[model samples]
Target: MTARSTQNKRKRFDPVLLLVLLLIVFLTGLLVQVILATDYLGSGLGDDVARFQDLSGVESPVTAVLLNFRGYDTLLEVMVLLMAVVGVWSLTRAPFPKKPIEPGPIQLAVVRLLAPLMVLFSFYLVWQGSHLAGGAFQGGAVLGGACVLMLVSELPWLKNISSRFLRIGLLSGPLVFLGVAILCIVLQGTLLDYPQEWVGTLLLLIETACAVSIGLTLACLFAGGRPKDDLSGGRKR
Candidate 1:
């Protein structure tokens, strides 16, 4: 076709694109108007705060809302993250490199110094969540950061860890959370309904398991595939 004819043909297709753009703009304007008209924000916060102390049984309002008032939300979120990791695992398993990359001396020094601190900080965050802003997700992220550091530094012991153990580590959190949920149903006749007296202890157990599981899952994701089993003789000791 001639250049001018080609340009005309392209213009013919432009109307469909223009209609989509106009539709998107109209939807955006409608959404904005709805948001502007809503008067629930302040009232909602006040309501949540007023009932927080009694409803949550925890000092931290955020924790109370997440792990108690809306515990199922957190459970589903954890399951979603686990599902994502499972999907990644099913895609492809990359071969372990013959010679692992070694971090420089400064990198090694920093990792050695920082890894322990990160672990300690992660636990502190998880423990503090009952009365503070930190929680299992934040603590798990910190722990994952520590694992990344260890992986990059090529720590001998870390490299030698068996794949089965790694899989268990990645799965521990979800398993524990699911188990607790089932136990609640069996013991309390409702999902996640802990007895008032046992709330704190049960919460602590769930958070600790979740934190460790999240940490390992995140670290395995960073490594990009399931680790090779040391016993399989795929990797040299």
Candidate 2:
């Protein structure tokens, strides 16, 4: 009976289950530790940002921080996004619908009307970033949504869009950003240190370029991979 009971215990043992339980316990303890260490009353960098907002050139403190004070971080973020899309493209081809469904007239009309308005609104958001809450990411999101709408509507032009143009759009933001940084180094002996007179202009340029790239990036991600035209050397498969 003793031997039989030991054999049953061995049969019931699961290393994977034990590991999962241990992981859950470890995570719970870490969460508790984080809770204990929380400082709810700690003041953040809002005051410092406001103190130097004028020097930063943009009317919006958030824009000043993102495009000016912490520009390096923003640069890395854009590169990361580009790398993500590149990685996705390398791993898989875009799985566009094989049987192209004829979109209804109403759907087509809605998309045609909305797409142009969205494009206009996206730039408007970019323009607002300097003085208001909207910025590149928000504008880019709107633009991406517009692309998605057109794609779903099966716009013929989108199917034939050249990979070359896509590549240019994807690279525009980071290239412009890095170019500006290099130019700043030449002019001011520091990376991204814009001349006072050029600060506003430089910020707008960066925002515009970044918005375009970001929109393309998001749209490409939604498409899930490289276009079929790119894979087939610009010929329809």
Candidate 3:
């Protein structure tokens, strides 16, 4: 019986299929490298600099690439973040921690002082992304850190906040991105393509919305679950 069981387990291990898959992956990678080495004619690097210059009204080439030239990529990245938060929500039942962790006075005080500073810096980072080395993701991380701080401190207001607002905050990025993509398709004949004249305004708006949504989503992720509303509990001092 033991020998039969071992044979059954061995039957489940498809070594041939595994080897075939490995060989296919290796060949695919090798093909790509060979094409790249031969200087593929369709490569984007050749005209990227010229395209970057012609994309009107945008100061940052990086931003232009992310939000304009390859917007679908950015849109997909935002969707990934949204999906992560959604997956977390789906798997979790108990919103918020069962036992509240009480932070000490110094920790609470530090969070109080640092939260606003981080928020201000995050905004700067988001705004500067158009001209320099910051963007929505960086700003969102700072903002998310602030939210995490608030949660870690177990602030009264945070604990008592409405779930409805939380849900809105979490879903805000994906919804806005999807709406913008659809609107672009209607007006520009392609997804995420902005009108030449309105490139700055539209991209800025999208980035701002994305930053906010990313912030909320990340905070929720750190919390490990959704927050529940407690209308009856008054704010603590």
lDDT on C-alpha atoms for all candidate structures:
0.80, 0.89, 0.77
Q: Candidate 2 — which residues are off by over 4 angstroms?
A: 1-15, 231-237
Q: Count the clashes in each prediction.
A: 0, 0, 0
TM-score, cand. 1 = 0.84
- The numbered model that scores best in TM-score is 2
lDDT of 1 by residue, 72-176 (tens): 999998888888778766654534466777668898899989999999999999999989898898999999999988887777566557777877877787788
| Candidate order (lDDT) | 2, 1, 3
Q: For residues 1-237, what per-residue lDDT tens digits would candidate 2 score against the true structure?
A: 122334574455566767888999999999999999998777688889999999998999888999999999999999999999999877777877766778899999899899999999999999999999988889999999999888878876676688899999999999999999999999999999999998999999999999999999999998888877676644333
Candidate 3 per-residue C-alpha lDDT over 1-237 given as tens digits, one digit per residue, 9 for 90 to 100: 122335475455466766888999999999999987984467666367556646745677777777777788898999999888878766553255556777788998899899999999888888998888787888899999998888778876675667788778767777877888898889989887777888788778778888888999888888775455423253321
lDDT comparing candidate 1 with the true structure: 0.80
**Greater-TM-score candidate between 1 and 2:** 2
Clashes of 2: 0
Model 2: weakest 10-residue lDDT segment is: 1-10
In model 2, how large is the Cα lDDT of residue 14?
64
